[model samples]
Target: MDLLSRGSMVSRHGLVLLLLLLIGCVYADSDDQVFLEINDHKMTTLSNMSNGSGRNEQICTLCEDFASQTLSYLQDHETQTAVISGLHQVCSKLFSLKHQCLTMVDYYVPLFFANVALIQPEEFCQKVNLCEMMASLRLPNRDGPCTICHNLVVEFLTKLKDPDLQLEIIEVLLKACGKVEDHVQECKKLVFHYGPLVMFELEKFLETTDICAAIHVCKASQGAAVAATLLADA
Candidate 1:
C-alpha cells in the first residue's frame, strides 16, 4: 500500500479507539451517579425508619397497657357471665378506638381463654399482632427478640437483691417477650417458667449464667451474637 492509504488506515483506527474510550467514560460516570443515588435513598429510608421508631414505641405501649387491663378484668371476673359484662365495660373505658377494641375483644377473648394456661397478657397481645407490629418496626442494629429477652433476664437476675423491684422486673421481661417474633412462644415459656423461680430461689440462678442458652434461644455451640443476627434476619 502507498503512504497515503497507510496513513488513512491509521487515522481511522485511532478515531475508532477514541470513540470507544468516550463511550467507556460516559458509562463509568453514569454508574457512579447511579451508585450515589442508591446510597442516598438508603440513607433517607433509614432516617425515616429511625424517626418512626417513636410512634412505634407509643403503639407498643398502648398494646401492652390494653393487654394488661384486659387480663386484670378477666382475672377479677373469672365466671363466663362476669367476663361477658366486663368485656363491654373494658371496651367502653378505652377512650380511643372504642369500637375496634370491642371488636378485637369479641374476636380474641375466646381464643385467649381457650389457651389461657399457656399464654400471658403480653403473649396475648402478640398473638393478636398488636405488639408484633412494634416488633416489625425494629431498626438496624437494634436487638432481636431473643437478645432482648436474654438481656432483660440478666437484668432481672442482677437486680434480684431489690425485693420491691423483683416482680416489676419479671413483668417487664414478660412484656418484652410478648414483642418477640421468631421465638415468641419459647421466650414466653422461658419467662413464665423461670420468672417465678427468680423471686423464690434467687441464690439458685446467677447473673453470669447463660439464660439465653437455658431457654434454647441461643445454642451452646453458636455464639449469642450469631444467634441474634440470625433471629433479626428472620
Candidate 2:
C-alpha cells in the first residue's frame, strides 16, 4: 500500500524506489488473454486484484504480504519459474496502480548471469533458444522493448550453461548502455549505481580505456568535470 516515488526520496542506498505490486487478481471477460499468454502462466497482482472477482481482492492482499515477507527467502535459494510465476502475478497488478506504487521495477526483477556459448553464429540462436518472447518483457505503453528487462532475462537463460547466451547478454547490455546515454540522468544513475558491473563489462567486452573514461565523463558534473579532465590526462 506504500507507494514511494523515485524523485522525492534519497537514501544511502541511492534513490528510494516506490514500487508496490499490490494489485489483486483480475478476471477477464473471456476475451482477455494477455495475462495467460504473455505472462506465461504467471499471475500478476492486477490479474488477481480485479474487482470483477470478489476473490481477486483477497488474493491480492494475501499475495502482497507473501511477496514482501518471502522475497529474501526466494532470493536466497534458486528461484524456480514456479516461484517467479507467483511473484509475477503479484507484480502485474502494479501496472494498474496509477498512484502510490513503487517505481522500483529494476530492484525486484530477477537477475540471471549466464555465460556465452562458443558455437558457430548460425547455430547460436537454435542452440540457446534465443527468442524475443523469452528474452524480454514489454513495458506498458512503450515504443520498443527495454534492454534492462531483457538483461535480467538473458541472465536467467544462461542457467543452461550456454556460453552463446552469455555473449548475447553482453551484446544486449552494451546496446542498452548506448540507449541509457540518451537519457543523461538515467545513464549517470545507472553508471553510479551499477558502476562495478559496468566497469567489468567495459573491461571485458570493450577493448579500450577511453570508453571507461567517457563513462566517467558521463557521470561527472561541474566540479567533477575538472577531476575527469585530470584523470583523462593521466
Winning candidate number (TM-score): 1
Q: List the residue pairs that clash in candidate 1.
A: none
User: In model 2, what is the error at residue 12, expressed in angstroms?
Assistant: 13
TM-scores for all predictions: 0.26, 0.18
lDDT, candidate 2, 13-72, per-residue tens: 121111111011112212434323323323232232223333233333322332333333
Model 2 collision count: 27
* lDDT accuracy of residue 80 in candidate 2: 34
For candidate 2, give the lDDT.
Answer: 0.29
Per-residue lDDT of candidate 1, residues 16-112 (tens digit): 2222222222222234654344334433433433333333555466456545644554344344344445455544654553555455446545544
- List lDDT for all candidates, in order: 0.43, 0.29
Please list the residue runs of candidate 2 whose C-alpha ends up more than 4 Å from where it truly belongs after superposition: 1-161, 181-234
Lowest lDDT 10-mer window, candidate 2? 16-25
Error of 2 at 99 (Å): 25
